[model samples]
Target: MKALSHLNKYLLKYKWYLIWGTTFTVISNLFGIIPAQLVRYSLDLVKETLDIYFLYNGSRLQSNLYDVFAFSILFYGLLILAMALLKGFFLFLVRQTLIVMSRHIEYDLKNEIYLHYQTLPLSFFRQHNTGDLMARISEDVSKVRMYVGPSIMYGLNLITLFVLVISYMVSINARLSLYVLLPLPVLSVAIYVVNTIIIKRSEEIQRSLSRLSTFVQEAFSGIRVLKAFVREENSATNFTVESDVYKQKSLQLTRVDSLFFPLIMLLVGFSNVLVVYVGGQEILTGRLTPGNIMEFILYVNMLTWPVMALGWTTSQTQRAAASQQRINEFLAVKTDLVSEKSLEREIAGEVEFRNVRFVYPDSGIVALKNFNLNVKAGETVAILGTTGSGKSSLANLLTRMYDPTDGVILIDGIPLKEYSLTSIRRQMGYVPQEVFLFSETISNNVKFGMPEMPQEKVEQAVKDADLYQNIIEFPEKFDTRIGERGVTLSGGQKQRLSIARAIARDPKILILDDCLSAVDTNTENIILNNLHRIMENRTSVVISHRVSSAKLADKILVLDEGEVVEHGTHEELLAANGVYRELYEKQLQAEEV
Candidate 1:
């Protein structure tokens, strides 16, 4: 029961269901005791009437012995039938109430975990793998439900039946009741020892399973890489290693679970032997009758099922405890990011960064240092940088994906932290260097940011991205299903689709971070031409390595090694003879070649 303390709140919330379910289970077991009692009474009646051919009724009316016997059998048969029906009805209620409550709790628990996942900072996700999270919510959740539902119901049933049957056995013969009770203490100790091992082993099995799931998920995600490298054999070997680890852990858990039932059976066998040995002597010594012996045997037999169930229930309870501990670890993690601001207003798209500095957690390298930028409303600022020059870090800060370690970022003259996260994020449309699309229809992907966006707006967005001609070529047009991560679409098409999705939201600020790198130069020019009209009076920040992409910007800032190196208009940067000029000359040489 201590193992179930983690679920106490849920249990208390559904306390009424537990109460009613247990009440019905107790009632069902009470009715279950009747058949054994009736069998004993019938045998005693037979013994008493063996010498009489006819019996005298209370009114001195002689009745045939056959009729008397028939009447008694018929009366007890109906009693047993009625009790059986009642037991079945109550048992059904027990399952319906408690099991359904467990399902409801499972749903609520999963939703809470998912909500917590959403609240956690980006760094938390960077630390946890997708497959491990999936395993916690899926497999571990089901395991907890087993403890909440069937294990609980069966446990209640065993307790109720054990009490009633043991009481009846004691009343029939106190000495024999003592014999039956002898094995129970040893059985309890065995359960305690075996279940301790079960808890540890179940945890190991769950962790191993999570590793295997992660391996499979990663392998499938990188199947193309494996195929391109012709490394299927290596991947198979790695998978076998992980699979073997999981198998070994599962076998260890099974070995622990396998010990409980046999110990219970041995104890039960010893109890039966005691019952026969003790009861036969009592009957022969004229202290007990044959009918009394039968009654004690029946009661002992009734105890057997519950004793077996005790083992099973104990096993399930330990497994569920192991799962509960795992889930609790996730729930106990406090979210690093907290939203305290209540401001929710339309953004005017004026952006500024003042002496902003940032370093990623556990990394000594700085991503951004003393970065300063101020873009007035309706200005288009382009950022030029090489790999690892903090281009994406700026976009991440603007979107509030990560907060600056030092200095302030302001939106519309207000501190970024003063605004609600949702309001700030909703006002910005970002297209990252690595584009991701859901496995959905093209129209759905386009409307992903704003699901209720009008169809006409979706069409206009696609047209603006210069993707209309390519999209209409598909057999299903806007309704075409792009498979996982939009794999069926070319890299350029995926980038364009990502742009359309952002534009469809009609955000106040548009941040494009190297989104056009996948498109050809000719296509990039066409898209830029369309963007000129879209960028009018819209605060936009474009990050790219291409000089051609920055030519139309109101300002261009060059970054080298996480610090701003130079800043000017495109023409001015070209004449500055700095990092920007060097990069421009190299691109020109490569293109000319």
Candidate 2:
């Protein structure tokens, strides 16, 4: 119930819808009550006319009275029909206003969750799975919609009908009305017990569903790997286990949920029996007429549906509360990375790391320690390092994907935090070691960083990355749809496509993090040769394991165990005969073999 309080703002936002829907509900119930009264009046009128006809048997006046009674009964039937039609029309209005409001709220809520997801840090994503995140936005939101729309609408209908129908029953005869309502207290107790059980079971069911969704999502995403490992049988068995858990949880909930209607009907049946038995006693005592008994019966039947719907409304509300609690959990998370200032001027691409130190928050592993470097605007610097030598960590810090645990990073003499995150990222192009591309056209993937890039620039970017020939050979050229994660392209082509995407952005600072690892030596040389021209006036950082990639840089760095072991120009480093020289000689031997 407390979790559901979060929806109050949405309720207030669409207050007019609620107001109109309530008005319609009241009018519909009013119209519905009129038909029962008409039935009672028609019954009593028929009885009185029959008595008069018996008194004037065989008289011409009796025939005149018969025609009058026939006309009156027809008029009553027409009036009842009109009331029912009006009731139905207003009920339609109730759905239009209330249900439509719920849909609008659903749209707003999903957008709000998605927008919040975009602001969350990469670490947050690491802590959660894709399927759980998707479930919250889709499945959880749908359950909430049930509470706001159908449950609320039916609950209102229940209240309105009960008030009108019960009031009329009591006014006609209080004692009989009391007996008719005797079973309602028992119904109330049953609902309370069932509602408590429903809340617990509903939460369990939702969790099971989330686990099932995650299993299916992972299985499909990693299907290629599963096939490669020949683990199809094991995967299917795991899927069956997850499915069985979900099935059991659902059945448990359904078993409890199944009790709702039967209990409601049983209590209602008791109320009907009481009405007939008690109303007969009243009639025998001459305190009630046959018309009165008939009208009471009509009123009881009127209350039946609403009373039955009460249990369903309660169950829906409980499920909604459970789902809202999950949604609120994510909504309450505050992102750790906060932007301090907005950049008003274009970046000059002079990057500096002043005694920077960093540790991965998730694993508590130190990736960098006392690292210091300064690159002037438009300079090319190549960082050479083995695996786990903090080479990628440097790239991560430059992109502001993670802040250093200690020390400061500056761009153009301004602290990195001083600039707006969006402004800094917009001016920087990064090609990561692990590349990811959308399942879109080749041209769209190339223009991913800048969607409005011109065709001429797109061609130039592909040419600069030395991927123009392969793309032109494709059937659709730039328009070819690369499958999921660029599966349709070869590894080298995918890497080159990533480079083309970065180049198309025309960024002031470009960082290529071992992006050419997959290309053959000849292709790597060709791409490097083109990059020498492309990187002329832009600040670039080349992170790689190859010495050939560093030969053209103005400066080179060799890193070992998160610390710089050697730094100098290529000729100077070769003359020094240190770690860089050793790596260069080893790579030269491998190429020769």
User: What does candidate 2's lDDT look like per residue over 1-593, in tens digits?
Assistant: 89999999999999999999999999999999999889989999999899998999999999999999999999999999999999999999999999998998888889989999988877788788888999999999999999999998999999988888888888999999999988889989999999999999999988988988898899888888999999999999999999999899889889988998888888888888888899999989998888888888888888888888898989999999999999999999877777777765698899999999999887788999999999999999999999999999999899888888999999999999888888899999999999999999999998886888899999999999999999999989999999998989999999999999998898999999999999999999999999998898899999999999997799998899899999989999999999998998999999999
- Candidate 2 to truth, TM: 0.96
Residue ranges of candidate 2 with Cα displaced over 4 Å: none
- For model 1, how does the per-residue alpha-carbon lDDT over 26-99 read when each residue is reduced to its tens digit? 89998888888887788878888754544454433345566777799889889989988998999999999999
**What global local distance difference test value does model 2 have?**
0.92
TM-score of every model? Answer: 0.95, 0.96
What is the number of residue pairs that collide in model 1?
A: 0
The weakest ten consecutive residues by lDDT in model 1 span: 53-62
Listed per candidate, the RMSD to the true structure in angstroms reads: 2.4, 1.7
Best by TM-score: 2
